[model samples]
Target: MADKNTQVQLARQPDGEPKVSDFQVAETDIPAAGPGKFLARNIYLSLDPYMRGAISGRHMGHSRLNQGDLIGGRCVAQVIESKHAEYAEGDYIVIESGWQSYCVSDGAAKDGVRKIDPNAGPLSAALGVLGMPGLTAWAGVEKLADPGLGDTFVVTAAAGPVGGTAGQLAKAKGCRAVGIAGSDEKCRIVVEEYGFDACVNYKNDDWEEALKEACPDGIDVYFDNVGGPILDTITQQLNLYGKIILCGLVSQYNRNDDNDFAGHNMGPFVGKRAQLLGLVVYDYYDQMDEFLRAAVPLVKAGRLNFHEDRADRIEDAPAHFAKLMSGQNVGKAMVTIGPESL
Candidate 1:
C-alpha cells in the first residue's frame, strides 16, 4: 500500500471559467477504514461542469468550498480494505470519492456508493455512460419526456455524456434524434459515433437555420443542456404541446452569482404550450438497477455508445475541468487516479 494519498484541492474560487492556478495538489497520509467504513482506491475521477457551481456554492445541495478543501467528484473505485459488512475487499464500485486517490466511506446513501456490474462495458464507464450522467439521461427519456416513434428529439451539448446518452435512448425508442453541438468535430462524434440522425454545429453562423433544416416538422422534444438564448431560440421552433427537458445550464455554470443566469422568454413557451420538466439526477438514484438493466444490454449489443477524454493524473483535473467548462472536451472528461485493480 502507498504511504501517501494525493489530492486536488481548491486554492481559490474561479471568477468565470476556471484556471489551473485555482487548484493545488497535495499529498497526505492514506486514510484507513474505521469500524463501519471501507477504504477504497480511486481509479477514475469524473469531471463535470456542475462542479464549477458546486465549488462556488452556486449549485444546490453543495456549500462553498474553502481554500485547501478537496474538490468533490464521483469516482470508480476498488475497495482495498473493509470493515463495513456490505462492502468487501476487491469490490468494484462507484462512489463520491472526490478528486483524491483514496477515500474512506461508510457506504452511505450520501456517499453515492454503488457496486459495479461486471458486465458493464468498462470500469471508467461507471463514471460516464452507466453512471450518473447515464441515469440523468435515462430518467429524462424514460420517466419524464417519454418521446416515442415518429417524435423528433433535439438535444443540446449533444457530444456530452448526458446529451449523447439521451439521444441514443431516444433513437432506440424510434424518435428522430438530432443534436446541436459546439464544433463540427463534436457534431461528427454525435452523428457518426452516438448515432444521432443529424447534428448542428452551434458555432456556425447559421446553426439556427441548420437546426430548422434538420427538424422540418418542428421539434417535439428538446433535451436542453446549454440554456440561455439557445433555449429561447429552440423554443421558437418547438411544435405545439412539445416536451422540453431542462437538464442543464452549462453555459451559465461559471456565473458569479445566481442572479446572473440568463432569463428565458416565457412567451415562446406559452405559444408552443411546452411541457417543461426540470431534471435533478439525485432524485433518480434508486432507479440505477432499472437503468443498468436496460443500458447494459444495449452496451453489449453495441447499440448505446459513450466517449471519454481522460487525464492520466489527478494533478491535471483542474485543467481538464477548465477545458470541459470551456466546451473543449470531446466527450466525458475524466482523470485517472490509480489502476482499476490492485
Candidate 2:
C-alpha cells in the first residue's frame, strides 16, 4: 500500500480561462482512516464546466475554493481501508474527494459518499450520466420542467451531459425535443444519436431563424444551460405559461462584471408568463438514487446515449478543464487516475 498521496490544488485564481500554472500538484502522507471513517483511492475525477466558477472564485456555492485549497470535485473511488461499519474493504463508491489520489470520509453528509452497484452500467457513468449531471438533468426536466406529450422542449448546450440527458428525458416523455449546440457536428450527434427531434447549430449565421423553425409551435419547456444571446432567442418563442429550467449560465461564467449578466428583452417573459426556476443540483442530491434508477436502465438498454472526453492522468485535469470551458470537449469531461476496480 502507498504511504503517500498526491493531490492537485488551486495555485491561483484564473483571469479568464484556467491554465496549468493555476494549479499545483503536491505530495503528502495518505490520511489514515479514523473511527467511523474509511480511506478510499480515487479512480476517476470529473472535470466539469461548473468547476470554472470555483477556479475563478466567482461562485455562490457552499465552498469558495481559494488559492492553495484542494480543488474539490466528485470522483469514483474504491475503499482501501475502513473503520466504518457501513463500508467494507474494496467497496466501490462515489465520493467528493476532489483532485486527490485518496480521501477519508465517514459518509456522514448527503454529498460526501455513497456506494454504487457495479452492475449499474460503466463505473465512469457514476460521474457522468448516472451521477451529479444525471441528477441535475432529472431534477430540471422531470421534477421542475414537467414537459408533457406533444410539448416542445428545447435545451441549450444540448450536446453536453446535462443538456443531452434532459433532451433524451423529454423525448422519452413524448415531447418534441430540440437542441441548440455550438458546432454542426455536436448538433448532428444530438439529433441522430440522442433522438432529439431537431438540433440547431448556434455557430451558424442563421441560427436564430433555424431555432424559430425548429420550435414552430413555440417552446413549451426551455432548459437553459447557457445564458447569453441564445437564451434571449429562446425566450422570444416561449409559449404561454412556458416553463424555464435555469440550470446553468456557462456562457457568462467567465465574466468579471455585472454587465455580462445583463441584456435580453424580458417582454416575452411578461407576455408569456414563463416560469423561471433556478437549479442547484445539491438541492436534489437526496433523490439521486431515483435518477440512477431511471437513467441506468436507459443507458444499459441502449435507449439513452452519453459521451465522454477523458484524460489518462490526473495531471491533465487543468488542460481538459480548459478544453471544457472553451467548448472543445464533446461530452462529459473526466480524468482517469487509479485503475477502475471491477
Candidate 3:
C-alpha cells in the first residue's frame, strides 16, 4: 500500500464557470481506519452539476466541498482495511469518499457507508442510474409526480441520468414522455435509445414551437433541470393542474445575479394551478430499497438504458465537470480512478 494519498481540493471559490485553476491536487499520508471504521481505496468518482454550486459558493451550505476544502463527492470504493464489523477487506462499497484516491469511514452515519454486491450490476451504475441520480429520478417521477395514463410528461436535461430515468419511468407508467435536450445527438439518444416518445432539441430557434407540437395535449408533468429559456417555454404550455418537479437549475448554477429570472415565470402557477415542487433527494434517501426494487429489474431486462460519459483519471474531473455544465456530455459524467477494476 502507498503511504501517500492524492486528493483534489478547492483552491478558491469560482466567479462564473469553473476553471482548472479553481482546483488544486494534493498528496497526503493515507489515513488509517480507526476502531469501528474502515479505509477504502476509491475506484470511481461521481461528478455532478450540483458540484458547480459548491465551487461557485452559491450553495455552499448544501455541499460538503467548501473553499479550500477537499472536493467532496460520492464514489465506489474497495475496502482495503477494516475495523467495522459489517464491512470487510476486499468488499466493494458505495461511499462519500469525495474527489480523492482513498477515504476513511465508519458505518455509522447515513449515506456514510453501504456494502455493494459487485455482481449485482456494473459497479459504475451504482453512481448513475442505480445510485443517487436514479433515486432522485424515481422519487420525483413515481413518488412525487405520479404520472398516469394519458398524461404528458416532459423532462429538461433529458439526456442526463435523472431526466433519462424519469422519462423511462413515465413511459413505463403509460404516460407520454417528452424530453428537452441541448443537441440533436442528445435528443436522438433520448428518443431512440431511452424510448422517450419525443425529444426536443432546445438549441434550435424553433425549439419552443417543436416542444409545443410534440405535446399537442399540453404538458401534464414537467421535470426541470435547466431553468432558463427552456423553462420559460414550458411554463407557457402547462396544462391545468400540471405538476412541475424542480430537480435542478443547472442553467443558473454559476450565475452571479441573485435576482436573475433564469427563465422563471410565475404566471402559470396561478393560471394553470400548477404544483411546482422542489426536490431534494436527501429527503427521500430512506426509500433507496424502494427505488432499487423497481429499478433493478428494468436494468436487467434492458428496458432502461443509462448513458455514462467517463474520464479515465481523477485529474480529468475538472474538465469533465466543465463539459457537464456546458451541456456537452451525453449522459452521466463520472471519473474513473481505476479503470482496470471495471
The candidate that wins on lDDT is 1
Output the better candidate (1/2) by TM-score: 1
TM-score per candidate, in order?
0.98, 0.95, 0.94
Candidate lDDT (C-alpha), each: 0.93, 0.87, 0.86
Q: Across residues 71-112, which tens digit of lDDT does each residue of candidate 2 receive? A: 888899999999999999989999989898889998987447
What does each candidate score in C-alpha RMSD? 0.9, 1.7, 1.9
> Which residue pairs show collisions in model 2?
none
Model 3 worst lDDT run, 10 consecutive residues: 56-65
* Per-model tally of clashing residue pairs: 0, 0, 0
Cα lDDT tens digits for candidate 3, 1-342: 556788888887766777787788889889989999888888889998888876555564655356568887899999889998989889998998889998898876744677776766799999999999999999999888998898999999999999999999999999999999989999999999999999998879998899889999999999998777677678889998999999988888777556754345677678989898999898888889888989989998988889999998888888887778777889999999864252
Which residue runs of candidate 2 sit more than 4 Å off their true CA positions?
A: 1-3, 258-260
Clashing pairs in 3: none
